[model samples]
Every structure is written in structure tokens, then in C-alpha cells.
Target: MKTPGHIRAVSRRTVLKGAAAAAALQLAAPFIIKARGETPLRIGMVDPLTGAYAAVAQNEVMGARLAVQQVNANGGILGRPIELLVEDSANDVGTGVQKARKLIDRDQVTFLIGDVNSGVAQAIAQVTNEKKVLHIVSGGHTDTITGSDCKWNVYRVCNTTSMEANAVADLLFTKYGKKWHFITPDYAYGHTLQKAALADLQKLGGTMTGNELTPLGTTDFSAYLIKARAANPDVLLVLPQGSDMVNCLKQVAQFGIGKQMHVAGLQQELESLEAMPPEARVGIWMFEWYWKQPGVSGVDKFVAEIRKVNNGKVPTARHWFGYTSVHTLAAIANKEKSLDAKKLAEALGGFELADDVKLQPNKCYYRKGDHQLMTSAFVGEALSQPAGDPEDLFRVDRVVAGDKTAPPEAATGCKLQWPT
Candidate 1:
């Protein structure tokens, strides 16, 4: 039983003790913060996660997520963890631009990557350029993204339409025939791809039998297939990608179009082939990246890691695009010791990717003139049945080097204007 004065004295001592403890904590706060390390470096990724390109776009996101995990595990970007903020473009140009703005302004991301749809990718590029954010076009293959519409800050991981066309044109002409018919998607990507392919065909003295500009997200491709078969072309090019490609090829097989003509296209994805039936998976095409490269330094490890998150599915080109995009930013930023967009952009112009990151036999580097990745094109024929693994649906015929297929930098119409 203490007196009221004694209780008050005890209370005062307790309050003084708390004050001293608080001061001690204040003194240790800086050390604690230093030990905890700096805040995460944010990277914003935009893609069509819920539309025609959803499967491939989601794969891209998956690859980016893995790269983020790898980056943070190593030492992170400039000793800071990487925070990847992903937003869905929904395959719309307007939505892509809006998402890009949200990531740049509200989220304050240091870098940006996106878009399977070339139109959406270009739209996002405008926003990224205005904001001066370092951007990587992860999957979009329109020629102008790294050509006429290219910006100082925008670099592309995927091959250009011209590169793809150059890769497969000779093979198609020699193996198939001279007359070609096309069922092309009506978009920037399809348009550019068709134009480039046509240019190559003409250069090889091949004649275009017909070209049907099918709308994006078209579920029924019977009419287009009918027109293509009716043309009686030596080869029928099914040029839509992602779900669209799956749909087109499915209808082509159902209608027995492949039996009538040699079916092929320029760029094909593992995601699309997986979605397709056995009969529909007949084509000669080019893969931007393939998971089945024997003796490739990092491909096996990459495939194993991707399988962990991708439901045991092997990685497609889209995944490599996303993975390479994030790693590119991290590698350049770490090397330069700065996140300045211009510095990173300048350094990236002729930067060569490491063997592990490249995952291909060829020397992969970003071309200085156009900021386009010079990666090998996996030219192959789609298998109706799995050769070995269930997911091994493609047999690589030849791995063409980018420098061998791609035109001279002067011909690409890419005049990179660096910021002063």
C-alpha cells in the first residue's frame, strides 16, 4: 500500500523511462533503416491480360514476375528490390495509354514494359516517351515500333516484322511454292507483317494470290479460310497471333485447308500451338525464342523455372521477351549505377545480352540504330504430334541469325533522336 504521492512518483519514473527508451530508439532508427535497405525500384508492365492476346500476355507477365524474383534474390537493382506493377491493357490502345499513365504518374515506376498488340504498344510508347521513362516493347513486333515510330526511350525485345519476314520468306518460297494467300489480322502488327512478307515474296518473284484482312478477335475464320483455299495458292499464310491464330488454324484444320495447300506463317508462339489441336498445328514458322535449344547456356534453367510457375508449360517467346525486358533494365541500371532514362537508353543501344539471358547460340544485342533486339529466329515446322515431350510441338529446322536476316540499319527508317 503506497501513498498517493508515492504512486505519482512511480508514474513519473515510468514516464521518464519511456522517454529515454524512445530517445534510444530514435538514435537506432537510421541504422535500422540502413540495414533494412532502400525502397523497392518499381517497374510497370502493361499487357492484354483479358483479351485476344491474354494467354501470351499472361505468359509475358509470368516471365517478368520470375525475373523480378531473380533480380531481388541476386542483389536487386542498385541494391534495391524490384517491385513489378503489372496492368492489363485489355488489347485496347486507349486502355493501354491510360494504364501506362497510371503506372508512370500515380505509381511512379522507374521503367515500363508491355503489349502483345502492336497498336497498344505504340500508344503506350507515346506516353512513355512523354514521361521520359525507359520502356521495353516486350512482345509487339510491328516494324515501326523500332522503326519510324521509335522513340529515344523505347526499345523492343521482340524481332521486327521485317526480321520475321526475312527469316521465313526464302524457306516458304523454296519448300512450299510461289503463289501465297494470307489471312491476316487487321491491326498494326498484321499490317506490318503482311507488308514485310509481301515485300520478301515479291523480291523472290513470288505472287500473292489473295489477302483477307480478318478483324482482331475474330472467333470464326471459316469465311477467310474459304477465300484462302479458293485462291488455290501454293501456300496459305495464317498471320493472326495468340487466340486469333489458334482460332484460325483450328478452322483451317476442320475445313481441310492444310491438305489443299502448304500452310505457314512468319511468327508463331508456343502458347498458340498449345491451344491448337494436333491437326491444326501444321505450319512452317519462326519462333522469336524457343525453350528447346540443346547446348544453349541458360535455356534449360529458364524452362525449368518457368515451368514452376506456368503450370508445367514450357516457356514461349513471349515469356523470354518479358524476362529479357526486365533483366535488360536491371542490368543496365546496375552497370551505370543510375536510373536516368537517357543514360540507360544510351548504354542499351549496342549492348549485348549475356549468354544466360540470351538463351540462344547467336550473339544477341540491341541494334544501335533502331534499338531492336538482334536475336536468332528459330525457323521450324509445327509438329502434329509431340516429338518427345508433350509440349515439344515444334522441330527447329534452322536458327537464323538476326544480322543475316534483318536489313541494313539505314533501310529500317529508324533515326534515333537522343534527348539533349
Candidate 2:
């Protein structure tokens, strides 16, 4: 565990320095694509390319593409060109599982990455582990992915539900009052996030005024908005994400409840912010990464590259997850000189992330205990006024080291079943 004092929230300047260092490491990486007359190493990526989370998933795929391009340019991994095969899970668990099998069994991909939906990610985890193929999830953030349901072949590059919850809970309570009402989704992702948020709130002497659980793919939030208005809590914690998140915030404005209480969420992404109207995008939430925040040495270069490919649009944290997961996987394979699932998993067990990745100043790493990538946690507040840059949606407010946000290993109940 990090010492109690290790996780102090920092200012933008300090965070920028950290970002610069990380980006510097990235810029220094060699990009030579030498051919060694070897067969290409294939990696299968599964994501919801056309659904509620399509925007975020598409950005993730773009990130992965950039990583592959960079690795191939760097003489390919171990002189073998990397080939990526993408499958659309459409945010469904059964479909995701089928796609996973196709990728592993037919495509014969040695590695796998992706899935925005927690349920789909969990299902894919089971498939990948059974096949003994190393799967690195880029966008899935369920606690169980790194907790009780963790598999040796499955690893995550995103923050867990608990980390997301604790990152902003204390700050929200401190800035706004403790009485809270929740607009939670009715699914594995929503339940886990809500539970984590409530636990953190309670720890900080906060109380839950009410909760309205809405079904997934909900279009109309009228009934929930009415109930939330009645509850009139200090903070309205909306936990639905992607299109649902955009819809909920829009409804909050339509209901005129934005002025009545402080609005917040367990997580927020660049896609949702772009989809949201300026009037509806108010409030504070946890952000996995923000492109404009300077710290890593090569972040500006990344942002420029992404913007060029994305038609001048800034890349979100989803993109970072995709890019980092692929690059990290490739780096490990090169270091170990093997793609054996067990060897790859072991290589990543305690691997520390370089400073050029837009996280905290402290070195981040994947905890061997749970296979969770521990990085810095940031809280962002959506701006109500025009910030000139359309991508300038949020003003980053706080930076907390991952060590402080992550729960202690003993508390996670992750029993790794590595092959003996």
C-alpha cells in the first residue's frame, strides 16, 4: 500500500510535468520496422463498434491502430509484423463470447484486447483464459475484472470501479454536501460502481437520499428525473455512461433540476462530453485521461497525431487505454521473447509504466496480485461556457495517484490461478 501521504492531489502544472516525462519515454521508443522472414503475429480486438458506446469504442480502435502502426514502424515486434483483427461485440455478452472464440479458434490470434461493456468483457475473459490466450482489456472497468473474477490470462489497463469512485467521492462531498441521490444503471457495471460510490461516501460521513435504477439502453429518463427532483439531494450522482450519460444529463436540463442540486458521475469520457450540450455537461467526474493536460514528454505529439487522424478531434481516455494496452503487450512480448500466456502474464506482473503516459508523477504498474494497471486518477469538471477549443470540455481539478485510489490487495479477494 502507498503511504498515507503519497497520494496528494496536485495542480495542473505539476500534472503537466508528469505528463511530459511519460510522453518523453514514448518519443524515445525506437520505431524501426525490420522484417525477419517470420510469420506475422496476430492480435484480435473485440469492441462495440456500433452501439450505445460506439463513439468511445471507435476511438479505442483508433488508438490501437496508432499503437500497431508505431510498433510496426519500430521494425515490428521481434522482426515479425503485427496484424490486428477487429471484431464487433455490439455490447452483448453472448455475441462477445462468440467473437472471442472466433478470434482465438479460427483467426488463431495469439493475443486479444478490448470490450467496453463490463459483462461482455467478463464473458470474453472466460473465453480467453480457457484458451490460454493473453487478453488485455482496454476499456472495461469492472472491479471483478481485477478482483474476484480475475484470470491469469486476462489483464486490464483501465481503472477499476473502486478507483473511479474514490477518485471523486471525497472531493464531491467536500465541495458539495453529503446528501446524495443516485441515478444508477441496472447491470453489472452500474451495480459495482454504485456499490463502490456508496461505500466511499459512507466512509466520508455522507448519506444516500435515494436511488433510481434504470434499465440499460434507456432513452427516456423522465420518471427517474421526476424522482430525483423530489429527492432533492445535495448531489445527483448519475452513473449511466456513454449515450445513456448524454441522455441523462440532457434530461436533467429539460427537467430544470440542474440548478437544484450538484450533478456528478462515477466516470466521464471525451465522447460523452462531445455528445452532451454545453448546458447539460456541467458537473465533476472522474476522468481516466485528458489529452490537453501536460506532463508526459510526448503527450502533445500524441494529441497532435490523434487530432490529425480524428479530423482535428482530441483523443479521449478510451483511446489511451487502447493504445497503451497494445504497446505494453508488445513491449512485454519483446522483453520475454515469447508470447506464452503464462510468460506474458508474469512479464506484466509488476511492470511499471514509464513517465510519458499522462499519469501521476509516481511510477505506475500492474499489480501482480490482481493484474490491475495502477495509474493516476483525475477529476474533471465540465465547463458551462465556451472554452474556444471544442475539445476543451473539462477543467481538470485534481490528480490522485493510483496507489491511493486502489484498494489494498488483501481486500480485493483475487486468487490468481497461474499454470503450475
Q: Which candidate wins on lDDT?
A: 1
Best by TM-score: 1
Structural similarity to truth (TM-score) of each candidate: 0.91, 0.90
Clashes of each: 0, 24
Error of 2 at 316 (Å): 0.5
lDDT of 1 by residue, 105-133 (tens): 98899999998899999999999999999
Off by over 4 Å in 2: 1-34, 357-360
Tens-place lDDT per residue, model 2, 1-420, is: 000111122231112122212332242233324467777777888988766777777677778767877878876677787766677898889999999999899878989998898989999999998899999999888899999998998889889999999899988899888999999988888989999999999999989988899987889999998988898899999999989999999999878887899888879987888887888988888888888766657778888877756656777898788888888888888888887889889889998876555334556799989999887777869886756876688888777788789999878879999888
lDDT of 2 at 29: 33
Q: Each candidate's lDDT (Cα)?
A: 0.85, 0.81
